[model samples]
Target: MKVLPRQRKAVLINSVLGVAVLAGAGGAYSAVTSHSDSSARADARTVTVAKGTVLATVSGSGSLSSPSDAGVNFTTGGKLTQVNVKPGDKVSRGQLLGKVDATAAKETLAQDEASLTAAQANLTKVQEGQPSTSTGSGSGSGGSSSRGSANTAPTPTPSPTVDPAQLAQAEAQLTQAQNAVDAAQRAVDGTTLRAPVAGTVASVSAKTGDTVSGTGGNSTAGGSGGGSASGSNSGSTSSGSSSALSGFVVLTNPSGMQVTANFSEADALKLKPGQAATVTLNAESGTVLNAKVLSVSSLPVSSGSGSGGGGGGGNSSGSAVQYAATLTITSPTSNLRTGLSASIQVVTGEASGALSVPTAAVSGTGANRTVTVVNDDGTTQRTPVTVGLEGDSADQILSGLSEGAKVQLASVSASGNGGFPSGAFPGGLGGGAGRTRGGGAGGAGGGFRTGGGGGGRG
Candidate 1:
């Protein structure tokens, strides 16, 4: 085995070179295998692009309230003798709601009547030709003084007469008495409180023995005295007076039920009077109350301000602005009651039998939509698409893809990049040409070829 040093060195170098080459080839093979495994895992995700319908809805919470709520109060101050209706009692328009103790009112009325009668009698007596006793002393001193002459010659002027002043005073007193009588009569009328409208009794503030009074405890009756009455003015003011009549028996017509929705100013602009709405109460599920927008207040409704986002976000707890939108119930249910929580869904727009795909299947920057479609050969292709009306679950695709094409949902990831596989062609490759066998057009045993038109790539 004797060998030259140069020959041995050459053989060693060759062996070293061979080892390095083998290492490089092995590394390349491992990398390729790892990449292929990752791609297989990505392809396992099932995505479906289907033909379906979608609906967009605006949801807002509100409370049930009555459009017309009336409070019944006593016009005159007295003990409540009788409460004809209790809370929850149905009543009719002009039905007797309650009665107050009229003993004091009646007695005052009697006194006023007596005074008026006396005044009228005095007036009659004055009108009639009645003789009155007068005292006048005419002495013969006049003659005696005239005869005595010299020292005392004086004459007395007759006192000026003004008899109309006494008559005027009497007329004024008569007018005052007549006014008192009229006022007393009105107070008597106020003793009986009647329902102003047909409705159910929402609340009863006054019991049978409770004392009711007018504003400032003033008389409810007015007279020719030209003084304004208290309760006879406005009912709202009448009920706001004192504790005796502070709270009132509320009467509400159930049919007049309305939903008070607090909407943001932006959403309010989309709503209009006479728009249809569906109301769902908290207690009732699967039941909808039909309603219409009765009115939208020009003024904004003040509410607690808060952030708009649902979950934890930047200052979501902060204040929010809202406005009141009143909706009248077109069809009311018996179970609906005041103070119940409700949700309203207002349909802004609707499409019947429109084509749509899962919202997840469509992806893009705002207003520019794209989707990743799965090719028949187990590869992904991103296709640029023109989208139409968006909905809860799906979107309308205007163009760029045909029905029954498989689309991939944006691969959800914790990072939110949509986890699309790298190097994968979108829409089955560019220029309307798909991956093919033998890597040539019209090649024998080649895979499906794309159309001649150019398109986007995945």
Candidate 2:
């Protein structure tokens, strides 16, 4: 283990060189880190709030449903005894669709008939004169009576043929009995479910032994099982959600097709009958059907339940009241199927060819509306603004701010990350890129912007 002088000398040199390399790496790391942080801070996004046309719209999504009137429902509830029609069966008005257990109805009818007959006989006897007569019979309890009671015929106190009180009472009883008979007969007939109008049977959930509740109608509503909330929120897509069919049998007029959706109460207020709208189906995504707001229900769909909605939102948790809306599809075809998810946008208000700016640029509420304006220097000033209309993408500038004014969309700090600004998540790092210098940019920054709808300010 004796070391040579030259070899020892070489080891010392190599060790020194390794230490120098470590020192150099440490310096380089600091420089690189500093440069990266500076780069991130230098990138600030400045945007101009311009003027443009904006539409304030109310959007709602749900299954392409049917009008409540389109459903054929049973007016009376009963046990389903027979189902004559299955799904897809076509029938006409007054056609028997199914039958219920009518044994009870029949018994009720029989009793009513007997009562009616007795009432009529009593009435007849009252209308006719009755003579008073007296008769005596002899009887002995312990011993034979000394003399038998004598039979006597009293002179008839002429009975008035017209006894107004007796006549009225008898008449009322007869009428009541007749009503019972009619009601009982109707109930018996109701046991047999029939089609009130002609259409195709879309479904039949009731079997022979199934007990079905009456919808207080004579027929069943036609559609898929989604007529009830069972269909609610099902088949929901980016477009909307739907509800279930509570009807046992659904009848659909294939030629008459429409989409029924529920919207928040706020949106409902903006909607009115005959308003213009557009409907998009989840199935035929490419098909943007032209439609109109047939009606917006004034009543709340559910109790204590309504979703906050404006443009492009429809989900609601528990007890959220929604107003039902009917959209008549002007060009619905065979391609449109029941229970298909759909989204609709009703033009509650519109302002065309007006001045507008990025909605993000405008902040504050009501009369205190303002936007942050970027000065020529690397500084921003909050500028008072008179906003006319606010849209999903932009807001209409009524006054205060002028066109081409560079509004500070957002200020970014580079100390964190210069690389992968769109961080690991959907939102990325800092508020993702704002409206670039270019106009009409959105669907960015955590996916906030939606349709061209704007809240009308003026």
Candidate 3:
């Protein structure tokens, strides 16, 4: 067979063109298939919806301290003579905590007694009548006898007694002496500082042999009266001074432990008397103390009042606003001490067996709450849900969506909706849809109730 060169060239060109066209078609098909696969993978997201419990809690910081902290100070301004109790010593009520120097006090007391006795004696003598001293010449006696003989009884003459002015002066001296004695007795009492109530000894300020003057730097004796006695004379001082001063010793009762927590205005509203609380010391880990809300102040404490400024407001520029909540520990452990830092969590409200979902599932605009429930065919439908107590991890679904309803976890993408596609598989919507089976059991809702059957699953 004889073929022309031109014809053979034409045949070769056609064959090359056919091969190129086939290659292009195959590439186009591969690209389409890859795009579909990627879209399917993007649409499906793994989510979990289940029946579980959720708790609502409020957190706050506070300090662990004894409610009754007694600040004991010395009545007199003397050198602290003796501190009988140490910081940790447990003392009984009326125990002898310490004693101030009684040297001046005893001396003063003795002088007061002597003055009182002298005053009493002087008063008695004045009342009885002054002694009469008679010094007369013999002529007066003879003349009196002749006159008496001539007539009836001679004109009776009143006995010359002590001067009334002298009597009054003696009485005044007696009163002064009595007052001195009383003042001395009081000074003696001020020397021994006793415990006013039963409790532990938190601190001791003074030691023995120290000069303790009454409250104001005045001498104990001087405190009693207006008279200023230069030397140590008990009777020289007046009576009213010592009674005005305070006791030398201070005793505190440490059994009643309390925690002061500052809550913001928002948190303060939720708190009420008798609410349960748990306290944990920052110093002691793993130790939880129980307490109850004793009181909540209607008005916030002034900025500088609390231990570290009002309720953790140290860094605040202006006056920090906070209300003081007093919490009394139901039981105090030895580890719990005054001034220890603590954190508290008060359970404002709690709901057990609540129908809850991952916080991510819920979305909406404004106050409206809604969740996207995936149907059996991989399609997602938005459903309105009534939200209840919400916690850190989950939210309580009060109504709308049931327990077993499938919900899309992540958002749908533009190319392929982020949720499961409709009818992708023969069975119901897969992926997160499977997780929505178990809804919480049903029971009376609201108001902390224990042991109620959980809400039912869808």
| Best candidate (score: lDDT) | 2
Q: Write the per-residue lDDT of candidate 2 for residues 1-458, one digit (tens) a residue.
A: 97669989899999999999888866755664565555554665678655557877777887664432234444455777677888778787667877777888799899999999999999999888565454444445796664645754344455545688999999999999999998787777666666655666766666877776653323332333322211111121111212244455556553445777888666677788888888888777887988887777778776673332223323334455578888888875555566778888887766776767776566677889887777888677888888776665677888877777888654333313233233212222223333221112222222223221222222
User: Would you list the rank order by lDDT, best first?
Assistant: 2, 1, 3
Model 1, which residues run further than 4 Å from truth? 1-53, 102-186, 215-248, 302-319, 365-367, 373-384, 398-406, 413-458
lDDT score, candidate 2, position 188: 74
CA-lDDT, candidates in order: 0.60, 0.61, 0.58
TM-score of candidate 3 against the unseen true structure = 0.52
Off by over 4 Å in 2: 1-52, 68-86, 98-118, 131-169, 204-249, 253-276, 290-335, 360-385, 400-429, 432-458
lDDT of 3 at 278: 92
Best by TM-score: 1
* Candidate 1, 158-242: lDDT as tens digits: 4434346655666787999999988888888878777766777766766888776654324332211111233422332222111
The local distance difference test score of model 1 is 0.60
Every model's TM-score: 0.56, 0.52, 0.52
